[model samples]
Target: MSSYLLPAIAGLLTGAGLIVAIGPQNVFVLRQGVARRHTGAIVAVCAISDVVLIVAGVAGLGAIVAAHPQVITVAKLLGGLYVLVLGLLAAKRCLRSNEAIAANAEEAESAGRWVAVGTALALTWLNPHVYLDTVLTMGAIANGHGNGKWAFAIGACVASILWFTALGGGARRLSHLFASPRAWKILDAVVAVIMIGMAVALFASI
Candidate 1:
């Protein structure tokens, strides 16, 4: 159906473009992938969250969220703090494990299911931008494009699933490639930069 086609294509592009970037979600997925942790579950959480947000946006609730300045401000402060703290913690982990990571790979498996869920949820719900971007912007465009709101939401949701799945699996492969303390340092540094950048962008955006 042409109606669905539009949403699918839009969703694919949105998913591909955003996922390809080395953003927070990507970092989390990659961490799972490399550690060979509960990659599927983590990826699934992100995909599901995306679908929910996109649907809400398309259904018009996204507009309500964007309009509430206080909510956005609160999300910014909270999300920023969360990101900064997480980034610091990750950096600390990297430093602590720099020498033993490659040797004790088994011990370095991801924390737990709850940790992954909390990380992904904070990355999604805590940032008001997710609401604005996927729900508000994508929803508005999808809805404005005629009777293709669900279609677009579907597209984006599908895209998110595919991307997160791939990244989570792909990152694990890097254990062989970046098998050095320097590599962990670099990755941790990059994560720190991304987290800090996200915080700055979020706060400045307000």
Candidate 2:
């Protein structure tokens, strides 16, 4: 038990280091969380997706993914373009009048639930970094534990779940901070820059 416990701890720390970074998915989750809209669905999608990827990595799927450079190339292009569009949309929101911004917020609340869910899924699965981090990197680390690999995988999955849950849940506390149209605009501007920067980085990596 002690041996497994150590590996699990290692996995947890490793997973946290890879996941808690600012990225498109985190930005989307934070936005949805602040808006207090479909946060549960978004958190669930992101956490569950991480679990699937981590488990697949532990199960030796990482080797196959590592060998597939073309797959990463395709994902990089698609993900970069997708993030770029999202950034442009956010930037457009920043240009709206206060009244228009408020109206857009309302429209977002009324938007289809599936739309949010789909966006969450796309942001998670379409990014090449997800495969590299969870599949290749985490997979190799867990496998290093030999028979304790499953324990490591479990720890990593827990880390993913806890991080997203906290991110989504705690973000609502910032609702007071985002109460005004100006505040929302500011948030959108920040998100726009981050997303666009990420898209540029992704494209450059290819």
Candidate 3:
């Protein structure tokens, strides 16, 4: 059997590095983890989406996308808008009933996997920066790894798995800690601030 150890590990680390930041995905993961709902779904979402995109990056699509000037411009605009919306939603979360968040989590419980995957795809494919990270950053990193480029990809994937697994698993323990409405409110408030700041920074780049 062909071994994907190096690629898997690289994939894992790369994915973790890119995703460990304070972003929407992290927010969603944190919220879901704190709630203890559909833990497996969340993990699958992060992992599967990573595999698909990493494959695309390694397949040369990353190179193609990097060459397009217009696409990059449009992507920056969209990323700014998306982050703004996410921030607004986060800010509004403080006002939302915990019941609503819990309910949405319930409704979302079934599709947690796809939700994660789709969310991953949207965030990556939709944001030109993802191309810069996965396709560009990861791709460049993959190059020097020699035959281990493939192994590096695998490592990146593994990193994602470890993080998400820790997310879902750790969430199980955090549920009780977030039992109060106040805690959720505070978290939402902070997440809103982060997202809004990122959104603002996006426009500054233009």
**lDDT score at residue 64, model 2, on the 0-100 scale:** 94
How does each model score on lDDT?
0.76, 0.94, 0.71
- Candidate 3 residue runs with Cα over 4 Å from true position: 1-15, 96-121
For candidate 3, the TM-score is 0.79
Range of the 10 consecutive residues with the lowest summed lDDT in candidate 1: 101-110
The TM-score values for the models, in the order shown, are 0.87, 0.98, 0.79
Q: Rank order by lDDT, top first?
A: 2, 1, 3
Candidates 1 and 2, the one with greater TM-score: 2
RMSD of each: 2.3, 0.8, 3.9
Tens-place lDDT per residue, model 2, 1-206, is 89999989999999999999999999999999999999999999999999999999999999998788889999999999999999999999999999887777777879888999999999999989999999999999999999999999999999999999999999987887888999999999999999899999999999
